[model samples]
Target: MMRTTTNSEITKGIVLKAMPYKENDQLVTIYTYEFGKLTIRARGSRKLTSKNAPSLLSITQGEYEITLHNGLSTLIRGTAIDYYQNIKKTIEAEIIANYLLEYFYRYEEENKPSLEHYQFLAGILEALDIGYDYRIIYAYINCFIMKENGVELMMDGCVVCGNHHVDAFSLESGGFVCHEHMHLNDLRLPKEQLQAIRYLYKCPIERLNELHLADIGPIQKIFEYYVDEFCGVNLRSRKFVKSIL
Candidate 1:
């Protein structure tokens, strides 16, 4: 059996990257406003004085309509609705955005589009569209990792030995520890930071802007523990981001 392709138009997405191709063309990966993720070729976009070049290269945000034909997708044209140079100017925004791209490409299952993940990225991008806030940004990402991995860490009580006066959180046990289960080497979080993390797990994304972290250091540490132990691979860019920040 033979399959044939059809041409169509798609009005969605934000350009994620513009990579060189041959002599005069470029390849673009867009986080589509409609389809989630898409790739398209922009023919002759590298030529000097080409009108589409600037727009295509600068199409960092907003929706776009692409032309498709004969199994080829091209950025025939698009208009910029909202854009900010803050992402490029601020190291925090840049790293966060790149981390997002890496996370999506690494974990997002193909042919399986999740509106939560898409919406989460969109929300974080909106937050980054403004000035950089390192702690807030990292917290936003840390909580997402938990949901993405389905690791519902018990925040209120110890997973190994339930205790009301829990002090230290144990990565191995999935939550805080009672005095009996607490190890001398286990990380202990201050009361306020522990509460901050608990609220983050329960907080809805829409209301996250109102949530405040008493301390991002411990939450970030806790998040790293989970990613290292469970997710199995640490983001290489994480180090770079920490260095620059």
Candidate 2:
């Protein structure tokens, strides 16, 4: 049996990660705006003379020409797009960017395109490039990712009893629980923290800078637990970012 090759398609994407393939080739995982995540082999990408070399680095945003052959996509050409030069200048920014990229790479199913997810990711990178508060940016992106994946936190009320005056969050229950229904191990979030989580869910990312978040520690912990418990994603970049902070 012979598999016919598809015509080359062009897309805009960011390189999530790049690894050395056989000899001069490079295996790159990219999150494209039009086609979602793809693992494509870039032939001779490591060579000095290769035109695609610059756009093959992890975190580089570029236009890619890909052709599907025998169930594998190969990179025919790449033109550098943003490169996000500002984000690469600082270690903290780089770590945060890497963590976000790694999170997407781990959870996003390949070839399932979501324009919302793509725009959310691209906007986050742009935010990081322009030097917004990274912690808030991280929390915002996490909220968007969770929402897009349909695991958004149940913030309306108690997940168990439908109580509007919820006071605790339960990792086991996957959302907020009323004081009466709260288990012994459930996290008791302060009133402000609960409000903050709700705001993150409702507010747009562009308005993130307007928020006067006193502390995001509790909010971060809640979402981190949610993603770990539900998605089973354990990102190395997450640990690294935490260690430095």
Candidate 3:
């Protein structure tokens, strides 16, 4: 059989999800530095003798050779980059890592490359691999993702009145609100929690390791509310991570 080499490109990417396809193939969803998110079919990847099988695992980073044909892209070859092996050492870490992948997969658009966002995801995965506190990493990554997407919470003041003294966060209003403007359903966030969010908003992604918060529950709730109301994503992996925590 003669092989055609048209439309082939090589890129670095991380596998977000890989599922069995047909008899001896795998369908992979990858987030790449050169191209945002892509769904590529891996031919003959299910067989034990396949060389590309190991690199297709979820959260595995690698370089991929992809060929596009008939509007569908197929991964022709792959080389393992960073498996982040430490992240798979424990169930909790795995769940959190999976949640991160799911969150990005749900929100990021296909074929629109944002190098900053790509680097942010890569940095967070590296942090996870190096044994950072999962909760802190989760909160920071959520905030960074939201910020990158331009839907980050307004921490400067009340979204409605611009008041600096905020008593609660109104998910419907999309920001913090003063006591006078607070809705009945708004979540009452403590001053410390508000300050923490403010810091996260301005903090650099690489400097996230230096931050320490005694309680992350409030911040996590804020992020969840933002994701649900704005991004319209309900991540099952997020729920699973919470259950085991």
Per-model TM values vs. the true structure: 0.82, 0.84, 0.84
Who is ahead in lDDT, 2 or 3? 2
lDDT of 2: 0.82
What lDDT score is found at residue 142 in candidate 1? 68
Cα RMSD (angstroms) for every candidate in the order listed: 3.5, 3.2, 3.9
Taking the tens digit of each residue's C-alpha lDDT, what string does model 1 give over 153-201?
Answer: 8877877756778778777777778778898877787877777777777
Off by over 4 Å in 2: 1-6, 148-150, 158-188
Question: Which sections of candidate 1 miss by over 4 Å?
Answer: 1-7, 54-59, 67-72, 161-165
Best by TM-score: 2
Worst 10 residues of 2 by lDDT: 1-10
Which residue pairs in candidate 3 have backbone atoms (N, alpha carbon, C) closer than 3 angstroms, thus clashing? none
The TM-score of candidate 1 is 0.82
Report the lDDT tens digits of candidate 3 across residue range 1-245.
11225768888999998888999998898998887788899999999999998889888999999985434589989999998999998677787888889977877877777788788788888988887778877777667656655685677899998999898878787778999999889988778887787777778766777777788888887876666666656778877878865
Evaluated against the true structure, the overall lDDT of model 1 is: 0.67
lDDT of 2 by residue, 1-245 (tens): 22225788888999999989999999899998878888899999999999999998877899999995555689999999988888899777788889889877887888877788788788888888988888877777677657656686677899998899999888787778998999999989888888788888788777777767778888887777666666656778887778755
Q: Flag the better candidate by TM-score, 1 or 3.
A: 3
Off by over 4 Å in 3: 1-7, 144-150, 157-191
